[model samples]
Target: MTLEVHGMTEIQQLAGKDLGRSAWRTVSQELIDGFADVSGDHQWIHVDAQRAAAGPYSKTIAHGYMILSWGVPMFAELLTVSGVGRSLNYGVNTVRFPAPVPVGSRVRLHASVIDVQPVKNGGVQMVRGFTFEIEDCTKPACVAESITHFYP
Candidate 1:
């Protein structure tokens, strides 16, 4: 479920809030290939199914960055900010890929608002913790702390 917050006031009150998990999204070979095409990272382990079959993972794997980029859409499924002038992706504080996301796997995001601080111009800087959990996997595919600034 999405947690909708209207205006800066509601956003500011979200510190330490648990946003919960998002819907599962499948990782397809086509998606991986598209990412490779756009990123110019056509490594055989990611695009060549034939060779990847003999690789350690025994199949094509999605790029860590590709899964990281999905943070935007995945987060949108958990929270919605409204009545603000703008919401900007400030940056990522930390990120790590603990496990590979093999093709045909499913991933979901578990997000929490870790901190919210008042910034200049009456805006708030929110630090959100995101964990990209791969289905049926013991380790998470990626863990990251994303920062965003919301202006009134």
Candidate 2:
């Protein structure tokens, strides 16, 4: 389910809230290849399926940044900020890929509003924690603390 909030006041009240999980999304080889093409990171483990078949994960794996880049879209499934002038991705404080996301795997996001602080100009700085959980995997594919500034 999506949590809807309007304006800075509503956003400020979200401190320490567990926003919930997003729906599963498949990690396809084509998608991985596309990302590699755009990012110029055609690592053998990421794009060479034939060579990757004999590699560590036994298949092509998605780049950590590819998974990180999904933070916005996947997080949109859990929360929506409306009635604001704009929302800006401030940055990520930390990010780690604890496990590889193999092609043909499914991943979902588990998000929490770790903190919300009032910033200058009637804006709110929100620290959102994200865990990209890979289906059937013991460790998460990615974990991060993404910060955003919402202005009214």
Structural RMSD, model 2: 0.6
By summed lDDT, the worst window of 10 consecutive residues in model 2 runs over 5-14
lDDT by residue (tens digit), candidate 2, 1-152? 89998878889999999988999999999999999999999999999999999999999999999999999999999999899998999999999999999999999999999999989998889999999999999999999999999988
lDDT by residue (tens digit), candidate 1, 4-97: 9999989989999999999999999999999999999999999999999999999999999999999999999999989999989999999999
**Clashes by residue pair, model 1:** none
lDDT of each: 0.96, 0.95
Instruction: Give the runs in model 1 whose Cα sits over 4 Å from its true position.
Output: none
